[model samples]
Target chain A: MTDRLPHPLRSDALDNRERILDAARALFATEGLNVPMREIARHAGVGPATLYRRFPTKQMLATEAFADEMRACHVLVEEGLAEPDPWRGFCLVIEKTCELHARSRGFTEAFMSTFPEAMDFAAERAYALRSIAELANRAKDAGHLRPDFVLDDLILMLMANRGIHTISKTARVAASRRFAALVIQAFRASPQHSPLPPVARLSPAAPGKVM
Target chain B: MTDRLPHPLRSDALDNRERILDAARALFATEGLNVPMREIARHAGVGPATLYRRFPTKQMLATEAFADEMRACHVLVEEGLAEPDPWRGFCLVIEKTCELHARSRGFTEAFMSTFPEAMDFAAERAYALRSIAELANRAKDAGHLRPDFVLDDLILMLMANRGIHTISKTARVAASRRFAALVIQAFRASPQHSPLPPVARLSPAAPGKVM
Candidate 1:
């Protein structure tokens, strides 16, 4: 069978497609992966049949959206790797992950869970995780991190950032910052087998006020 | 009206009631709270009429079993509070809670959702939490803990121990111990604001694994 590109869309048809995706992103932010298909069509000023014709199913649409996020994350990781300072690179991954996952409207569990092809997506996550691990190991070897520390531990902490959604936005940033600082200190002390920094002696950020 | 004690149970009636609970515990552990009452009576070696006499409805029977678990937790909290060491009291609360909740013989999502009365159990949990917080506060005042920390953060981390359950059992234990030591260091450092002791540093017990 000869493979052919999708027929070029009229300008109106192309605009409608972009509108549908924008609506889908909004609906997913509020209603998660289970939002009604009709709502997306209505928001996009298209009929239900048009949506079905274009995306075929929710999973296909979600798979495409998820792939976009993977691409965005890839850019950030590459940027982090390019940094001359390993610690800054590591910190960028920490800060950007918390910010994006916490503050954005684009990412959704619905897109993640509803896609039947999530295994392929999961493999991508695994690859991304290995890249982060590589960054941590480089930092450790450079003596910025503890030698006994494994990169997987940091990954677990990062993945657990999913729980950030449960907290308020203001608190989320503060908690992330505090947690990041603690992890960094933990990494520094690990190689020397030095004890954790005394919680009291460390400079207090502010009482009752979170960073 | 003044409350009065129930009439003394006949030996046979008491034996039959004990038998019923034992069978229910076994069934619920293996089959969940939805196990049929008829099956419960048959397994208990009791007639339908006798089972109904003791527990008129399935909810009543489930409440009894669920209440028993909650009451056991209540006692553990009380016992832990009576410990001489402040930190040990909180530690016992963590260990005991881990055992009971992890090994519970029932999953009562239905009861929790369907009945308002079922939600009253939070008071008991709050009481236990308050006791632990007091111990942490006392420990801090004694120069035994980190000064700036609050007990809720510790409780959250302790409660999140189950979150780490995805790893190996040995990993679970090591994480538990690592957190315990971390908490202790934090507790001691709170008032002193000094660095934690080297002995408080925990190495991953899981060899050849990174997480």
Candidate 2:
């Protein structure tokens, strides 16, 4: 078939597309969505015309860049749902989600920001929230989750988790782990005396300190 | 005695200084510390020369702008220290501090950012930490706070609280209150199920929805 033909031009176009995406993801992850298109093109070693030809708008580039993370986010929700124990599943989802966000500042911003044009992104977010809400109801029925817990509480937790910043990605994740433990404890139906994860060295007093 | 003399020029300079500080505080609270010097002057109804004469640099302006908040912060710590119950004291400090920071985004940024020339700010911060550490120790001794609770956990909570964004100052404060309650529950040595403050409507799903 023509579609399966080994065409040199098509292969090169595919390679350029991949390179541009890679650069966009890296820059956005580090410097956030404000990084200019020209900088992304330079980083990808592609011409301005080629970059524009592939992704005409910054929003398009951002939506494409975060596509993988969004998919991973859905998989996380699925994994939680697959768990037999609803409470444990909920905790797992919170822990994993916080860690995922901690690894990429850009993803957190994108997830929280209202992008009117990104319908798919919004729909995916709504789907994930619904799944979590269902899981929460199960946990509440089992009397393992706090009765007062609301779906908006999860949003509050995510927003709070987004505030964590450290000198290194590793440290941010560590801090997030401890934070997740605290949050899980708060959300539990009963106060279980569990040892928290080790503290991450996020003190601003000791500037330049890494975890 | 000469300092008390009511010279017209001195009174006018004092009025200008007050206006500049007020404008700086308002702008910094809403827009952050990045607002330009000329803009601040314009907001204060002062000339560029007068603003520069009053505050030679942005750092100096920021320092002066936040002086009142710094004092208020110290008062909060002192009030907490004076409370009979160490746990209650700790919780009060957390709740009030978070509310204070929530009202002003710029103050949070300034508190977290290290300014080399702002020695007073650093010293006050260190003092506040030491006082909180002393309070935590008391709480631990009294068997009220979790044994594993560290000073850094407070920092973690503050950073997380800083992440909350709402449509209005009232909503932000409400969200911070709820977040503080959650953190307090997490920090408690015993799991006592108390009702949380009413949840603030901070969901991004319903964009433009105010609390």
Candidate 3:
């Protein structure tokens, strides 16, 4: 496997590809996906000709850039899980999720605009969430969390806090942290803490007219 | 106020309007909203002229149908709240929501296709949810439920559980019940029960991809 590794030429090409993606992420973050290919190439320290030779299309470059950000998120969660304390581990994981969501909000909105159903990305997401949920459950069973908590509810609720990204950066972090801590407290194994009020029933607006 | 009650003629007209809406709901459920005005009038035991007078246009008719169903859901939750147990009340409310969702799925899809956002509907929905959440919180405070729970989490998770609908009705109900119980257990202020797995992260797919 070592002997079959890329020679100097292939290694140089690989480095250029990485650089292009880096440049695309920065550009996409700043100027967005429609930014000129020439600009991206310039930012990457490569000529437009070299950029096309690598990605062949702007969509390819943008996709790669977006995927790189997602890959970084996966790495962040992995690192979070490496923490010795499961409570700390889970907190770090959720916090990392909020950070990534803030950065990729534009990408997410854009992606879903074209794919209305969102099932394509939903597949991979479902798998990852299920895995993490299992881990959270294990921690709960081990007495790290309150027993009545389920991972599925927390995941959707946290992600559904889409309002968090719209907040100011400093406030965003504070809000995200508050949201995480609140959910965590709700997961406690004991009823030492107070819960929120119960939900009310919706009234029918002249409901007798249910045609 | 009693002396100022509507004249008999006005009362008769109001009854006719309600009759028309009922016919519209049935027709929309069976044949959908594209059905001719004559057909709806026929179903309502009135003439096309009457439906037009009551509804004004197709959009108004559709909105009325949608609002009618939502109002019915509101009633179900309200009635459920009178139940002796808070858990039962929550379950009853969710069950009604699922039933309404099953019926309104087509109507909502058609409506949203023409108008991308339903800000009014969403706001009303959030308002209704806030009420339900408050009730759940009350139950928790009363030591009737686990302390670690969020109402938004439960609602979102239920919405996400579309798969359960594909199964047999009995099975679907059972699954929903179990799902609710699991959430309730997770919210239980105890250490013996286990927390559910981690929340699922949605995959932000590339646009133009649904599956």
Candidate 4:
């Protein structure tokens, strides 16, 4: 009976935290990281005081909001490293990472931007890159990836993948899949001449026909 | 003497117009299409009244500023069509066009955005696409381009190209060149396994090392 007295209040606090994070992720994914804390609070149906009490700064909120995605990124790299075939592993990482970024503009911005103050985030990013570089070296040694493939090529491909804009999430993913396939083909050491994934309707001017 | 009386006024008007366009183009290229008319007037050393009298609206200013680029775009297509090898012509168009867009963000936004009121702009874009479609057809018929290539693939490539962000114009163009080479390889019907262009420094996190 004595412990039960505090249970409701603790659960309420947990609920508020979840709501705040949900709102933050949705807003950030859609509108980007520029969304104000007050707007986020409003969306989450919490007071500014409660929001600030929980997250003191925008960066803190962003880091917390993207924590899940950051973990997923790490997991992706780990999965790629686990694959026995280095080329297939490298391709898997690129395709999955591109799809992940394509689905969330805010995550892309956060990952790509240099956050000087966020040392942990920076470390995680470096670790991911180092792992990928190791994977790439293995692929190159196996004579699967092109000899000239550079780490910068992955960055270049990611930046290009980020440019994909579609009317719907499905369209974006579809477009990303095709783009990744093309990039993989480009990165191949030997020409397999595989048929590309079907084109996504990305033409801005005309809707009926692409040209 | 009566006819010559208005010569100074006409020349002054023409000079103001040129200054306005020069300012617009510079700002739009560097800062994008969101720079205000007042800021543009200030940059041009012209009064707001004069700027408005010259350009009427932001769209007019943009259209006028980008006229030379538009003409250059047309000339690039024409030059591509003049090439003896249809495959070479197609590659040339893609490479040059990607470079063009890489150099100017404003031009890309203007080109991609559907300005419902800008009928002439739409018509010009249509003409460009149709011409490229004709070029693609010739390339495919020559068995140079992959059979599965569709016109939307070009749009997809352009959109992907637009994702390129670099610290300098040179780096951006370099990155675009590498990207174009990769795309061209991906689009080839036969795997040439050609060497890729040199990598550009595009890593946002570590400047000294890519990975």
Candidate 5:
């Protein structure tokens, strides 16, 4: 198949496609998935036609842009499962994955939004949840996790973490870490635990206000 | 003031104003604060002119619409503070206040969103927080609440509760109650508390999908 194409032309097309994907990822991370396609083309230094030739729609771009995050989430869950201490591993996945989500507005929305076109990503999410559920069971058996905790409790934590709004990315990451720690404490079978992370001052924002 | 007004005209005008307020409260409670002014007028069986004469702007209407909710919240906090058992009082505030917020979307937004014209509402909110803070101190001294708990955690809980989205209002209320219970459990000084309320199944929703 490669021999059927002109080498230089094929290589240039591939390079442009890579540039488009890279630009989409960067823009989506900071500005969310709503960034315009034309802007993405300009950021990639590619013509609109060239960009559209590689990716036909915004959904296609989003599906491709978020593939890496889904993989990273999968890797995080797997690493937690591999750990000898089930409870520590469970906490690791929650803390690190939430931090990852906090860093990217687009990935956070994509992870939580329903998209029929993103079946592969959805499968990856389900796999992660299943692995975490197993880890939760192991942690409970170790007498570290509260026996009454349910899978939905983790879901509840994520939903709560999703509400955190801040003035800056650093503040958001800080807030998420503190929230994750609180959740971990809540999930602990015993009351003994380390001191919580410092309070992340929550500035007034939409939907949730400190006032 | 009554003597200064014209006789029959004054009574009719007062009646219209009360009708408009009643309609706004009902609509805002159900459809949120964004219900159209004309729609509110129609719902109240009055003309647009009457609605406009009473409330020149949406913010004024919102301020009027949520005054009751603010009062209710203030009353709930005061009731909690008056409870003899400080820890139980603290739990009561968390459970009932979240239930109140969950019951009305307009009031929820009004509670969180900053409003310069709503100084009275803001003062009420501050008063509630102050009383709750005192109650929290009492809970800590009672040795039921974890000493590490902070006022910001209550803010965090409210914020998280705001993120809950469901297919119906009933589902939202159920989720909020369950979340409040989990939080209270987490905040408890000992693991000797009674079993948690059952999980209110989380429906799939945007910005926080459940697998």
Candidate 6:
């Protein structure tokens, strides 16, 4: 009964809990989801026993630690839903969601890998997808989004976005932003309004007319 | 001197060599590049020493085995170059190249990973990219391809296409075809011509103005 207390703790226990979470958040953000728990405890200045006593499982800790980010996701989706223009709303959801994923490697991996025990997180993801679907339909009806866009295309974009390899985290985010813009442009039921840069190839060939 | 013979062997040795290559091709095609050389030797009904004698390194084996496919690639690029219409040629190169990659997981990985000692393979890739780049410039000059399309976009597509997870290779190929078409359309200079399928979202949402 005591093991599953929502918040049964003295002052020091509560402090220890906060330190552990802080360490976890820092490590997970910088190093990704695979950071060892013992290392996290060491960083937190807490013993392994103390860390284990507070958070029974890694999944539990991930769920709790990422709760804020999840809430941020919910907020972003809601904001998208609230937009008056459905197409803009759809784009907002995509751009923001991708940016969110790009910023945190751990969260990105977690979201895709499916923490089976994290029912709430799963449910939240499902709900978010449903909302985005509705937004897509609205955008299509508004004639802003192409009629033929499939939901999997978004997943396709995300999976592709995940593959963007750059030198630094900032470079990744910058590249992601550009990728998101390109995706948005691709999705728009419109013509090319702006000129692109010079074409480069992955294979050997005669150099094209480079202007 | 024997090691440097390069096909100076007798009839049975040549037969054994062919069998070894056949085995390597089958295994590499189905199981990716990670399959053990011993397994390949066993499959070929040859002693491991025989296998080692023929091809001292995995890179050499891979380089020789994939030479045909690489030749096909060069032929495809040449065919595109032969076309009077540069834009059509560029699109053909992309579509065909993507299909080729999608069909063979091993080739896809090998091409991207760049095995050390496979200098010839790397040179071919560089040559192909150069040809594609020339095609791109001609296409843009022809007013068919967008001016801003970069060579890296092809890399982006390949990287993204690699992420398409599906139950069957056939399905993955199909999805890849659709994805290629989308990318091609996105790269085209003109406005959206054809209607798309319904938008698919990764997250859940209410049915917004579904038509």
Clash counts per candidate, in order, are: 20, 0, 44, 0, 0, 34
Q: Highest TM-score: which candidate?
A: 2
**What does the lDDT come to for candidate 1?**
0.54
Q: Residues B1-211, candidate 3, lDDT per residue (tens digit)?
A: 1123455447777788888878777766545455787888898899888889877876567667677665775687676677777766765666566545445433433322323323234455555577678667767776766565666445433433332332333433444444443344445555553453333222121112100
How do the predictions measure up, each by TM-score? 0.61, 0.83, 0.46, 0.83, 0.74, 0.73
Better of 2 and 4 by lDDT: 2
Q: What DockQ, between 0 and 1, does each candidate earn?
A: 0.06, 0.22, 0.04, 0.22, 0.15, 0.11
* Segments of candidate 1 deviating more than 4 angstroms: A1-4, A10-12, A34-48, A66-69, A83-88, A104-120, A142-144, A167-211, B1-76, B88-118, B155-211
Q: lDDT per residue, candidate 1, B108-137, as tens digits?
A: 232112233333444665676687778777
- Per-residue accuracy of model 5 over A87-172 as CA lDDT, tens digit each: 99998999988788878877876665445354455677678879999999999999989777777767666766766542246656
lDDT for residue B167 in candidate 1, whole number 0-100? 35
Candidate 2 residue lDDT tens string, A10-95:
78887998899999999887666767899999999999999998888877787788888999999999999999999989988998
Per-residue C-alpha lDDT of model 3 across residues A85-152, encoded as one tens digit per residue = 77667767776675565554444333322222222434445555665676687677678765555554
Q: Which one wins on lDDT?
A: 2
User: Residue A83 CA error for candidate 5 (Å)?
Assistant: 1.4
Better of 5 and 6 by DockQ: 5
- Chain A: TM-score in each candidate? 0.71, 0.82, 0.56, 0.81, 0.80, 0.83
lDDT (CA) for every model shown? 0.54, 0.76, 0.54, 0.75, 0.72, 0.70
Candidate 6 accuracy as lDDT: 0.70
Q: lDDT by residue for model 6 over A51-97, one digit each (tens)?
A: 98888878778777788889889999999999999988998898898
Q: Please state how well chain A of candidate 3 matches the true chain A, as a TM-score.
A: 0.56
lDDT (10s digit) by residue, model 2, range B67-153:
889999999999999999998899899989988998897787777545544435767777888999999999999998878787777
Ranking by lDDT: 2, 4, 5, 6, 1, 3
- Per-prediction fnat values? 0.01, 0.39, 0.00, 0.38, 0.24, 0.16
